[model samples]
Each structure stands twice: as C-alpha cells, then as structure tokens.
Target: MKVPLEIRPGSDAGLGYVKYGNGPVHVLVMHDWLGDHASYDAVVPWLDGHALTYVFVDLRGYGQSIALTGEFTVEEIAADCLTLADQLGWGRFHVIGHSMTGMITQHIAADAPSRVTSAIAVCPVSAAGNRLSPEALTFFASTVDDDNALRRLFKFVSGGLSDEWADSKVQHSRATVAPACRRPYLDMLVTANFVDDVQGLATPFLVMVGDNDPGLDAKAMQRTFLAWHPNAELHVIPDCGHYPMQACPRYFATVVERFLKRHTT
Candidate 1:
C-alpha cells in the first residue's frame, strides 16, 4: 500500500509524495522528464525494509501536485524539492533522481552537502554540449499540438518500445499540470549547466544508463564526468531504453538498494 502525503508550498500549489519503509535515512527520489513519482512505481514494492524510508512523488507541476504561481523554472523545481524535504523533516537523506531530476539532485548535493548522504542518477541529461538528434528535434516540433488521436511519428520520437507506453507517458505528462512548468523549467535548464565531478560531489554517486538509450553513452559520459570522485560508480543496463524505471525495474531496484546500504551512514 502507498501512503500518500501532500506538501503545500504556498497558495494554490502543492506536491504529492509517498513514503515507503522505515529507516534512519530517507530518500528523496526524483522522476525523469515527463514522469511523476509513478516513475518509481515498479521499484517501490521491493524496497520494503531495506531502505528504511523511500520517498517518491510528483513534482510541483506534475501528477497531482499544483504548480506554483507565476513562471516555473528549473530553479523553482529545485526549490520546491528542497522545500518538500524540509516539510517532511528530512534534514538529511539520500537522493535518487533520473534524467532531468538527476541533474537537480546533483545541484542539491553541491548546494547542501550536509543534507545529502548519497546520490544516484539514471541516465542524467547532459550538462555540457548536450545535443539532440536532428530527428529528435523534428519530432519535438511536431508534438506542439495535442491532437485528437495519437500520432505514430510521435511514438517513435518519444523513445518507448511500444506506441502504448509512448503515448501514455507523453499524454499524461503533458496534461498533468500547469503549462508554466515547461516554459520556465526549460528556460532555466537551458540557461543553467551541470558538471559531473564526483570527486567534488561530497555525496557518494551512482550513475546508470540503458543500452537502448540513443547512443547508449550515459555510462561513458558518467565515467568521463565522475572519474575524479573515488566514490563514483557507473552501470549500463543491457537491452533497455531511456525508461529503465519501467523497462527493467529489477536491476534498477537492486542498484538503488545496494547504493543505499553501502553509503548511507
């Protein structure tokens, strides 16, 4: 059973979260782009007692949470997450973020080393010279309007193994909350940057990527970026895609469980 919790940052804005297990350390889990806390759905059940408490949920503008007033920037999302942590009384916790959220997790770690015990990013978005394929850019352009019916071309661009998964992730993600989240989020993200210096990263770090991910080079990138950190490690999942949370959750869960047990003091 999932225990639901709500964090109201202010007027008209709230974030939804779930707490699983009971342990000395709590985990602040972030989802990939176009995903909610549900991104961790497949892996949560198995976390049981091993992790003490595993917290995963939708951000301010995704899933059941309401976006804040005015524009929603990447910084805003970051602030909201930190605020949520404070509200939950998690002065210190482990963080596990996927994709865009992984980037944010690093920001948090850099900003507050005392509060973060460890960090994990599964296929983190590129912070430096990140380039999308021409095909991907074209597909993103075509998805500007939500059509009455699903488009096959869109499914191909979104990186799902099946049209069903692609459509569901996109449609639900787009329709989840306020539109400001994207405009501001994108603006802030494009303007800001990330660097993978695990040595600099006070928290122990774990980075994982999937074989099906275009280029499947997240591991290489992680290694190049995090090589300086003695505690940094990387893993590449075979026969999987960008959506490894749903694609091969068993491996995902194991990696997370091990990271937590070994690092968290």
Candidate 2:
C-alpha cells in the first residue's frame, strides 16, 4: 500500500518530517539535492512497512521546512537530523541518505556513532566532496533558476533517461525546494571536505549506486565510501542510473530493506 504523506512541522529547533509505517525498525530517510522527501515516493509502496518505520525529512528550505533557513553546511545538516531524531523520541535509528544528503549521513554517523545504528548512502557524494573546478561550479550554480539547465543535468546523471522523467523531476524540485537555498547547498556539495572525521568509522554502511551512474559510480564508491569506512559494503544496482528510487523502485526497496534488516538485530 502507498504510504500517506503526513508532514510533521518543525519547531524552532528541529526540521520537519513525514512519518511512514509503524514497525519496529526506525529509519531516518533524507532526500537529495534536487527534490525533497517526495523524491522517495516511488519506493514507498514497496517498502516493508510491517518491519520498518521511515521518517522522511525535509532539510532546511525544502518541503515542509521550506520556510526555515540555515548555514546549509554538512555539520549543520547533521545537527538538524540529530535534533529531529531526538524530537521523534528515537534513541537509536538507521539512516538513509540520497545524493548530497548521503554525505551528511557520514557526518551524522561520525558525530553520533552510538545513536546511528547503520547508514545507507545512495548515489552519494563522498565526504571528500566533488571538488568541482571554478568554471564547473559556475555552470552548476547557474542551473539553480534555469529549468532547462537543471533538466539537462538530471538527464546526464540519470544516464540519458527519458525527457519525460527528467521533466517530472525538475518540476518536482522547483515545486518543493526554495531557489535561495540551492546555491548554498550546491557550494557545500562541491567543496566541503570532512573525510578526516569519518575515516575508519565502524558504523556499518551500505554504499549503493546505480550501475549506469557515470559520476558517483561503483569505482567512485571504491575509492571513497568503501575505502574510508571499515564496515562499508558496495552494491551496484543494475539497469539504473543516479536515481534508482525513481527509476527502479521495487528493486531499490528490496535491496535497501535487505541491508537494513540484516543490521536490525
């Protein structure tokens, strides 16, 4: 069954989130750069709700937290997530982060290793960051307001997926994310480096990437996530690109749940 989107508004000190399921396992799922929590809507129906509960969170200036603003740094995001978890009365929980937020997951785990049970990073930017060149950074920053540019960028990451899909994603992003937050968050994605904080982290991590993802591919995972964490494992989803939750929801849920279940005990 499709889970209803129930938005929980944030307080002055917390981020807003959508709660799903009533299961034993608690999971905090964070969205990527483009869209909000709604980005995971495609995989909601396939989720094993009977065994797992998910809290889909909106970062500052996104979705339910659209009115909120912040420093937009990884440390700030990690702190916000921890604050949200405490508000939800979750003592220890699993975390799942997609794209840019995936890097935040590392920070969360590092900051509170005892509280985060395990982490799943999907097509994530590494802690070392993308380190984009000045010109490339300018090109990406320009896409914040340009629909066509955003669509083209999504298309490339999705391995030349259909225009219809890219368009839908762009529209969703425009609707949910505030334009002012994009550049600041993009700056963090391309330049922030905190590999030193997370290196040798013992918290288990499932580093998942789409086989067709040209940027954060399996090889990239090997050199970054897998190399930095002692208890990390890599899984490449077949016939997929950057956004597997959108492109292959069923399989994505299955893989995610399987890993989550393994560490639940």
Candidate 3:
C-alpha cells in the first residue's frame, strides 16, 4: 500500500509552502508561471516519503501567498525561498523548479552554493533568460486577461495534449494566480538574465526536458543549462511535454527520485 504524505501548512514568514514527508533529505519545490504548489499534486503520491521531504512553495501572488506582494523578480523569488528554508531550520536542501521558477533554482544555487545540495530544473527557462520578440512579448503579456490565449499556450507547450487538460490548467491559473502578478512576472521572465553569475559554478544540476516540448526541448537544454553548468546533466522524457509531473507522474517521480537519491548522500 502507498503511504500517506504528512502534510502541513507553512506557519513562518516568507513564501508559503505545503510541507510533505518527514525524511532526512530536504527539498524545496517551486511552481511554474501557470500554477502554484498545487501543480505538483499529481506527483505527490508517487514521491518517496521515507527518503525525502518536500516543501512545495507558493511564490508571491500565487496560491497561499496570493496576498503577499513583491518586486516579482527572479532574484526576489530566490531570496524568499532561501528565507523560508532558514525559517524551517534547514541548513542545506535540494531545489526543484518548474518553468519560470526553474530559473530561480539556478539563482539560488549560484547565490548560496553551500546551502543548496543540487537542483532539478523541469522544462526550465535558462538563467540566460528567454528573450522574446516584441510581438511574442505582447501575446504573453495578454495571457493575464485572455483566457483563450493562455489556454492555447498551455496546449501548445504540452504538445497539444488535449483541450480538456488545457482548459483545466487555464482555469487553475485563473483561480490561483493574482491577475496583477501576471504581467510583472512575465516581464521578469523575459528580461531577467544572470547566466554570468551561475556559469562555472560547481553545483550539480539535473536539467529535465520533455522531448515533445518544442520551446524547451533537449536541444535547448544542451545549449543553455548543460553548456553553462559544468556539473549539469540532461534527461529527456519520452512522450512527455512541458509538465512531466502532471503528464507522467509515475515516471516523473521515478526519475526525480533517482536523481535525488544520488545526491542525497
């Protein structure tokens, strides 16, 4: 029988998180631009509670932190996560970041190398940042108000998975994310670049990308993350898209656990 997770709400200041497990190895999991900590709900049941503890956090203006506001920069997000870890009394931890927050993982690991054990980036935007054209930037910015646009974007990234899936994700984003937080976050995603800061760092990174995810595919990982971090490794999930934890929970959990196990010691 599968073990039930020991879940708890964050009581301390900084980013709000839902804590799971009671294992010795600590991990901080952050969400993408689309959803909050709930984005990892599908993968929770498959995670190894006996070996690892996870704290799924809500960035400013997202989920439990919806009332918390900030400058909405990746640096600010990284700092909030570190602060939360300090409050939780964790001196060292691993970080798992998805999409936008994936970039934050790099920032955290580079800024505080002694504290971060390793980083797992899922369909991550590189520390170099994703520079979009003016037209593309305008379309992404419009996602805050245009549900259809956001839904279409989700569908495209997930390799046209299904309309139902796309719709669900769009609805989740609409409900959990603050509208005012969207544009500023988008600007941060497009403009933030700190590749120079993370390059040559000794931190180990497991950069995962879905083969079907056109935007952040295996080729993109090789050119950016793998090229920048000397200790980085790449994994391509077959038949998956942007959201592996959501699209292939069991397989995603297996891969993530394998990586964590190697570094936990």
Candidate 2 stretches greater than 4 Å from native: 1-5
The order of the candidates by TM-score, greatest first, is 2, 3, 1
For model 2, residues 1-265, the per-residue Cα lDDT tens digits are 5544467876687898888888889999999988899888889989977778999999999998998988999989999999888988899999999999989999999999999899999999989998887887877887899999999889988965799999898998999999889999998999889999999999999999998997889998999999999999999999899999999999999999999999986
Per-residue CA lDDT of model 3 for 117-231, tens digit only, reads 9999999998988889898888888888999999889988896588999999999999999988999998898898898999887888999999899788888888889998999
Q: All candidates' lDDT scores? A: 0.65, 0.91, 0.89
Sum up the clashes in candidate 3. 0
Pairs of colliding residues, candidate 2:
none
Model 1 agreement with the true structure over 155-199: per-residue lDDT tens digits: 542355776777676676667645656544544544456564323
Please state every model's RMSD to the true fold in angstroms: 3.6, 1.4, 1.6
List TM-scores for all candidates, in order: 0.81, 0.96, 0.96
| TM-score (C-alpha, index-matched) for candidate 3 | 0.96
Off by over 4 Å in 3: 1-12
